[model samples]
Target: MANSLSDRSSGGHQAPKNKKYQMKREALEQVIDKHISNIEKHSKKLPGTFDKEDIHDLRVNYKKVRAFLRLLQLEKDAGDLHISDKLKSLYHHCGTVRDWQLFLEELHDVGIVDQLPDCMHRWHRQVFTYKEQTVHAIETTHFKKLLHGIIKELPRQLQEDTVKQFMHQKIAAIHILLLAAENEKDLHSIRKQIKDIIYCIRIFKSDWGIPFPFRGWKSEKELNEMASSLGDFNDQCLAISLLQPSYICKCDYKEQHILRNLQINWLHQKEARQRQLLYEVQELHVEHAF
Candidate 1:
């Protein structure tokens, strides 16, 4: 698998100081610097003959950068460095391609491809066209400019704060949110927050030599398991979302029957996954409370 920016370490060459631990402004700066460089490097490859991994890496890195920005609450700072919307739009473009790829891959993995009705080939072709158009959009000068602008502004937007304090606040906030979640949308939000927190913790550990400060709650491994569960659920949701639109169109009876079965299975899986996620969330809340 091609390594996404998130997969790479933020500190490439810098050595952590042996002095007392502090989450200085420069720690965040180093993260932004590395991410910006990674984004630029990956974006350059986007216009080439890239595969699924390339697009996946590009999108994941972009989200890491955005997550870092949000972590620092810098999105609206002075209104000059607000690039979340641009990054989000670009991220969505990548997601569309990725989701389609995953959808097909899911079918193949489940032995459903061979069983799929012939009319579903039309859906596959439609996904191909969508991927092509999205890739072309990435090649635009405007997209490049937006990426460059983010790279240029992010360094100047970082603020100094104690790493311990930052971690506590962010983690506590996420815990509260997770505890309050009542539905899939809320659970999805918590998953994203957990991911961002884990990313930041890893960066601090690898780049700044700071250890994870939280205790008696969730370990990184546990958090990763939770995220993976949520990810599977989200994938099912995306597959269903993409499949639903084609339902309204006219198709052969056999085709419709297969499609309906696929949709029903996906929906059933999603519901089961939701219940499992909710139970996990409840467990997380209990662990955190003690």
Candidate 2:
């Protein structure tokens, strides 16, 4: 991915002649189709698949398409990313499964789930149930219509000049978020903003490759590292909150009681993750728009 990213931004296969920053019409259409297809591919593969990466990839594809729709939506006259209530249900179903996956993975990582076999088993069962639910949503949802709407919205040419200007505005917004961020929500805004940059580039690339942040910007790896840290802290925070007595835990009262007894361990872990994320943010230096 890193090598391909470098190749793309450095005037490789992604951009058209003269290696312009913008994508061509045909390239943009291919990108749109690719993401829609990949979303289906991952959603199908996740039904009985044990690999968590598939779930992550499915969500990534969802975000990529959603980002493109969002861009078009902002233009008002272009198009809107208006998901039907049914489609929104499907989207949330996927999220439900992902949260279960994250909830378990974090517990297992901290050795909490490992100590309680029953809790782990219950969590896995819940994940399987939600996974099947997501599969059902995929099979029944009107995604074909949603995808067709996006295809119909394609413009004659996705000029680089327009995309570059849009990205510059987003980066400028990120700059403001960075200086004003005093809490985790602010950090999340920063992370999502960087991801918007990434999603836009990958949406245009045929290979779904991440593009190098335009000239005079942080490397793709560095940007990912920053996002990773913030994501980790977020997962940790979620895991801790799930342990609270009011949460609708899948574990029984007895098991939930046992889990709550060890809540301090997860709390400590969350604090450690918080510090790591803060350090990452402190060292982060957002260069002005390219």
Q: Which candidate has the top score in lDDT? A: 2
lDDT of candidates 1 onward, in order:
0.62, 0.66
lDDT of 1 by residue, 1-290 (tens): 12222333354423233333333334555666676566556656765355787777777667676656665653334234545454566567768878888877877777766665565577667766776666665555365566556555543333333334455565676768766777778787878877776666665566455454444354667877877888777778887886674642565666667778888888888888788788787776313422
- Clashes per candidate, residues 3 or more apart or on different chains: 0, 1
In model 2, pairs of residues that clash are: 22-160
Superposed Cα deviation of residue 239, candidate 2 (Å) = 1.7
The digit string of per-residue lDDT tens for model 2 on 102-219 reads: 7877666766565667767766777778777888888886667767877777654444556666677777887787676777678778878877776776654435353433542556
Off by over 4 Å in 2: 1-22, 72-77, 81-88, 112-125, 204-213, 248-257
The residue pairs found clashing in candidate 1 are none
After superposition of all CA atoms, the RMSD between model 1 and the true structure is 6.1
**Residue 289's lDDT in candidate 1:** 28
